[model samples]
Target: MSEERETPERRRERLRQEELKRNPAGSIHGGGLPDLVGGMGWKFTGILILLLIVGFLIYSLFFR
Candidate 1:
C-alpha cells in the first residue's frame, strides 16, 4: 500500500469545501475575512471606524 500526502493548497481547498458543507454562510473564499468592508467603499468604512472609536471613547469616559 502507498500513501500520498496532500499538498498545502489541496488541504486548504478540502478544508474550505468541508466548512462550506457544514456551514454554508460561514465559509470564506480564499480563506480570509469576507470582503464586506471592501465592498462597502472607503467612505463607509472610514465612517464606521470613526464611529467605533468615538463610541469606545465615550463609553470609557462615561460608562466606565
Candidate 2:
C-alpha cells in the first residue's frame, strides 16, 4: 500500500479549519475588562471608592 503525503499549505489549512471549528471566533487575547460597576457587592464598592478618591482629588485641584 502507498501512503499519501500532505503538502505544507494543505496541512496548515487543515489545522486552521480545525481551530475554527473548536473556536469559531478565534481566541480571546487577554483578561477582558472587569465588570466593576455591575459586579458583586465588594467589587462595586471598591470601584465606587476609587471613583470617589479621583473625584476628591479633582475637586481639591480645581474647586478648592
lDDT to native, each model: 0.67, 0.62
Residue runs of model 1 more than 4 Å from their true location after superposition: 1-33
Evaluated at residue 36, the lDDT of candidate 1 is 51
TM-score of each: 0.47, 0.36
For candidate 1, write residues 1-64 as lDDT tens digits: 1125775545655666787799976644543533456346569888998999999999999987
Give the clashing residue pairs of candidate 2, or none: none
Candidate 1 clashing pairs? none
Model 1 misses residue 32 by how many Å?
Answer: 7.6
How much is the lDDT of residue 20 in candidate 2? Answer: 65
